[model samples]
Target: MSAIPVTIGRRAALSLDSTPVPAGSPLVDTHGRVHRDLRISLTDRCSLRCTYCMPEQGNEWLAKTSILTLDEIELIARVAAADGITTFRLTGGEPLLRTDIVEIVRRLAAIEGPDGRPVEIAMTTNGIRLPEVLPGLAAAGLGRLNISIDTLRRDRFHELTRRDRLEDVLEGIAAAAASGLRPLKLNAVAMRDVNDDELVDLVEFAIAHDAQMRFIEQMPLDAGHTWDRSRMVTQDEILGALAQRWELTPVPGRGGAPAARWTLDGGPHTVGVIASVTAPFCGDCDRLRLTADGQLRNCLFSTTEYDLLPILRGTSGEWEQDIDGMLRACVRGKLPGHAINDPSFLQPARGMNAIGG
Candidate 1:
């Protein structure tokens, strides 16, 4: 990909000078899930207040000053890539809400991958604001996109998002696909009595538009801490629903990826479902999240996080040593499952935005 003179205000480019990982430490987790993917949270700021993810009373966001600087985030990504992470994702409280995202993507593309190739950079957005920034992002080395579209009905979209712009979102998807973004991924959360009936239609839309649709099982996260199991729609139910129209079959894989792959009978296109709640994929979970506040989370449901910014701002040698040490230290403490399914479990202190969901 060619470099573009992309500029985003409020942040600056970071230089990567960290040495390669020592011989002993490997990036793969116990479940054979290598640290090939890194999701970095730029800020805990978003434009919408969804009921499932955001509180009705609104969330207490981290102060802007406390969030990781762009350079600091880039340093972490460099270290992470050394440990085998190549597929990097920029997330948010809506990453687009950040003041310097385009520049951030440009800087990330400069971070070399394990094999000296430019890493595959992507983002997950709500897509309402995508049209305005799609060209900038594509030119800045972003190759893939996953947009969250929970409902097709305008009123229902507002109910799910607590905002309006279904039209904007659709247009953004159209623009992204038309821009050669390649088989755009649509993220739809399957909520009982909410968008369940829209599953068939969602599949139709994906097929018609030549996009891959992924239905996510609503998990107990964010404002959904008090999750209504009655409101939950399991992957089994989703499969049953989709099976009505097409003869769905499994697409086997190494299983490190979260979504279980499936193809429609006699069709080339495929769809996926993330059974995070009913069928937890924690055992094979390979991903890790870096919060804007500089905490390294081993698991989404894991309560404790090891902070790394202080070391980064410290002496360069010690910072590199400490970051490498922290990466090694995090491996032993990683959790097999988030354990969010436990009714009595108190969620870790961070909100979805804080953790960069």
Candidate 2:
């Protein structure tokens, strides 16, 4: 919890200004991609500076006052649930960095989706703090987890994440399995000449722990804006390497799912690959993003952002309807895909952490 390097910016735009709106029909975009998943950033501060995620120093941080409050977070979830967003994932620079995350989970877990089912709440964490917060999170109804762990070697772990917390992360993963966090998974970003050599080892670790593993293609979300396609480890190469050691087969019915899963032959273990760069899945993407500062991103690589704070904080009788209209307009504006392969592509203004991981 010690302070790290950060530059403060205007935060009145980031407050937990509530954005609750009147319940509307299921949110479907112009491309007919219905909004069913919502990724909400709880905070823009993290405990580590992963080389691929953020710079080692001089990164800007949102003032705590500008971060959304627990109430504000819950209200957004409730409104999204009404729009049929049943699967909600709480991400962040590190979601655990938020002091009231447990309460936030408790409130979000209570929301009912349009289908009459309670919203399914999950979290993506760095795992260092899971040992301390896992129990509270589980009790508060967290359905599952995706832990970010890129390396198995302690030295490499520190080198990659800029923190000596690999052991803590491993412990957190173990504790999560023990605590009954079903469908627990590990997220690893596959970068050429970096951690690709350890892909098999990472998958083995997941199999041994009775958890799923997913390797994500490196995208242009780094704070330094240095990502290039040549440096990316594609799904074909990843599968080729893993196939040499294990028998893997694709699992069917992976529509719109970010991860294309495969089962280890004769075993109950599975692994996934999110090839955002080489094998884009934008057509089936059923998700939206809400930054910790209250910016709504229609796509992970969206060039446009809708500021929902003013409408959220507005005091007007028709504000709810107006909020509903805004939601529809934003959804309607969703991009068909993130053109990473296109030479004309440009990265978003915010990094992955600022965009909620």
Candidate 3:
């Protein structure tokens, strides 16, 4: 196939970065699902070119000016907060790459949830630089940390992420623990014949570190778009592997949560498996994604995006009403599921990094 230039018509290419959020009711989709979780991507720039995430090269980077400003991010979040959204997760190509992130946290932490309680703020980072920034982040009101560590073996880590900073990642994990970021979570993407052999060891590492560990089934979010179901290590395989060494028991009430919890017999800590590819929980997925470019995605695999940038940037007198209406429409259009296992599934145009983790 020959490369073709793509362009959005002017009607769809407005910029919005200075709009304010007006008071509103909770954001509810057509299916009667209320939004409570928001994932915001800070930037699309990353330090590691994980094979499953970004390509080795030739990624058409978003123009720096096209990315949302911190103020813009804050305003969207504030509106979401007022709409009963209590949890916000910051993601990135690497969120820590943003220089103004701490200040961003400081501003967001000031927004109260609909319950009048402090909003729960969390982040997912590769952990290479956690040691240097964890303290600042913790003091700025970050409540949870999800560090991505796919392998304990240095060689395997290098093979997976195309980076040899395993030692730095380990140090960063320790720094996160020391900073008192409670309920630390570790994310490992399980790939067939790659790092599958290290699953149990990764869990044990998490147990020793007092962190909750989750093995995520690889999804079709890679920039390469070469995802094959046969290449993924599924949830059942993960459990069977864990059962070989540790007795496993399922935890109750796993609804809406991405990870299905399991108790490790004879151990105080637990482990989880996010079977997104095999057994998706999209029906109860209460999360929304705001891309770094200010597009609102109701579903992770949503083909369409609601652009809020132009509205936020424009001088329209009815910007708030426009935003509120757009939010309702996005929610109403949310698909019941991503339909990845079906033959008719359509891969998202952008990779996971661009979509927000």
CA lDDT, every model vs. true structure? 0.76, 0.83, 0.83
lDDT of 2 by residue, 212-322 (tens): 999999999988998877998999999999999889988999987899999888568899999888888899999989989888888999988888777666655344454
Each model's total of backbone clashes: 0, 1, 6
lDDT value, residue 30 of candidate 3: 60
Candidate 1 stretches greater than 4 Å from native: 1-25, 30-33, 341-344
Model 3 lDDT tens row, 1-357: 012111111122111332333345666666677788999999999988899999878988889988998777777776677667788999988999999888878878888865679898999999888877777888898889999999899898888788888998899888877767888999999999999999899998998888989999999999999998999999999999999988998888986778998999955789999998888888788999899998999998989999998977776745545555566567767888899988999999999989998
Cα lDDT of candidate 1 equals 0.76
* Residue range 247-284, candidate 1, lDDT tens digits: 99898884667788789885698989998877787777
Which residue pairs show backbone clashes in model 3? 14-310, 15-309, 15-310, 16-309, 16-310, 16-313
| Candidate 2 structure, TM-score to reference | 0.92
| TM match of model 1 to true structure | 0.89
